[model samples]
Target: MLKVCHMTSVHKRYDGRILKKECVSLVNAGYDVTLIVTDNKEDEIYRGVKITSIDFHPKNRLDRILNSKKRMLKKALNIDADVYHFHDPELIPVGIILHNKGKKVIYDSHEDFVQDIKEKVWIPNCIRIVLSFLFKYYEKISAKNFDMIITVTPHIVDKFLNYHRNVHMITNYPVVNFEDRKNNKRSDCNQICFTGLISPLWEHENIIKALNIMKKDDISYTLAGPSDEDYIKKLKDLDVNKRIKYMGVVDAIGVDIIQTHSVAGMAILKYSQTVGGKIGTLGNTKIFEYMYSQIPVICSDFVLWKEIIDKWKCGICVNPNDIDSISKAITFLKNNKLEAKTMGENGRRAVIQEYNWETQEKKLLALYAQIAGERVL
Candidate 1:
């Protein structure tokens, strides 16, 4: 078996795409897979992927960026794997180092960095433009040295095509077990849920505010994910806290547990989408997750999302920016439980047929096969 090592300086050891999905998938496909991450200091194995944990507790964001890359490079040099796949943008320089050592280096572009930089709320508005420009050019120059570039979306692949020679678009889809399709059959729960990142950039605040306007006092909510301490505190202050149950940080199983008892999902992802024309096209991971879990989604009515929702008849596409529209969508799902249950079943069917990780898994296996000079599956 060909040895493959995936390194991530920015993300967690169990990042869904990089580690859990990519590394775990590779392991099942008969590769000698290993993962290196910055979070955990103690090394261990879970789900067949061997993890090489590094101790790097940084004081601040800058320390993690600058220090993690340096530490990552030092540890990466000794791995000596046939292929080194890295996910962090900050690890671009390290990729070049591995390439020079006659190792196949793959850069996984997780996001459109240009747009991400523009949407970075922490970065000062004045310098964001300049930083975005410089980062784009820098990535372009660094990516040229890598063997292949694996991007999360087609839109992101376009951004790298001119810069990198070998690039592939691999959409991140939720891993749904079609065997347990019966479990996904929806029933009325009088509850709604939101899973994953709860941030202002993702318009999480809109969903919270909309709940206030909702007429249904009996409805409770479950928020299952990590959040900034300050922002979490702000949420605690909201009067809706009595109805909204915050599950702090939940694992995949925990999310499933929440979804099992939930009726609807709120997916208001609008980061880098505030512009009038730039509506999301590729779709968010949470949307697919909600679909697979057989939860009717109440999400932003972007053009692309509307196209998919209309075709699938899976869920309601609402104006996320307006609290009234969000509340109305919630009420519609609540008052009409049978309709909501049917919509949830439609969503699960959509996932089984077209939107599950199985399709993307084939693409990933084919890519790795090509890299290893093996016959494409």
Candidate 2:
């Protein structure tokens, strides 16, 4: 039997879309899979996938910085597997070591690290720039050492195409039939909802600003996700606090509940130099969830998003950085109830037709087949 070892260096749980779908698919394909993750302690199983957590010394900054790589290298060396698949960039060095030992290694690039580094406020800009350069250099060199390269977006594929000849695009789409919940009637009030990590780049401020412009007491905004203390404080300081409702980090079911009561889903990401570069070609997860819930969407006018929204006629697209534009889009959706419903239906149809995971799964399995040298099914 073929065995595959998957690695991610930092995750509290093994529940994200990419990990979950990949685990399920690999197990069904008859591969004995082992997933290595990092947390406080070692665990045995996560949603039926075998998991091994490492015990490392020095939980502090410098210790963690030095030890994480060492622990991952040790874990990779010990695992008895036919192939080592690395999902996170931090494990690139481990991949290198495994390749030196004549092992097949797969590097999965989930995001564009060069662009993503700009959004990290904790790091000084100078350091971020230097680190970004070094990361790209190492990524190009290390990626070539891998037998296969998997990425979540075409843009990411383009980044490594010059370095690695065997590159595959495996997008992070939702699991098929996971959000088949029927659409119930929205609340009597006009409800707008936003989901995902609450951060400055997400541009919750623009949403609040748009709400304030509406000045309609009948509309309510639902902010669903974990918030940074600073960002939460900033939201509270907004003049439209009374119109906002905070529903902390929620599961898929919670999202369904919120969407059932919401008229439209908000995807108002701002075009910061940092965010613009990182998210330009990426599809946000919430957009599809919103479609699955059959709610109209108001998204930023990013090039990729515009192609999707325009092609599907799913919802309105506006400049997220412009308060007036966002407000106008919201108000239009609110006033034209029938149009909103139609747009929501169109989005659902689009997802069911093309964007759903069932369609993406074939590509995923094909990549695995190419790697394992046999058809997965």
- Per-residue lDDT of candidate 2, residues 1-377 (tens digit): 67888887754446465457787678777778888776656667655678777665447655755678888778878886778888778788888888888778988777777777766778999998888888888888777779899877667787789878898877666665744656666536467898888877678887888788776685888888888887787787894647888899998789788887777899877775433443465535667778777888888787777888999888888877788988888888888888888888898887888887766678877777777774233
lDDT of 1 by residue, 1-377 (tens): 88998998878887888877888889999999989999756898979998987678778889888788877888787777888999888888889988998888899877777767877778998789899889878887888788789886556676688877789978778887767845554455878898888876556677778777665575777888878888877766673646678889987789888887887888876636322234564535877888888879887777767777999998998776887888788888888888988888888899899987888889999989988993222
State, as a TM-score between 0 and 1, how close model 1 is to the true structure: 0.91
Which candidate has the top score in lDDT? 1
Question: For model 2, where is the 10-residue window of minimal lDDT?
Answer: 274-283
Q: TM-scores of the models, in the given order?
A: 0.91, 0.92
**Which pairs of residues collide in model 1?**
none
lDDT (0 to 1) per candidate: 0.80, 0.77
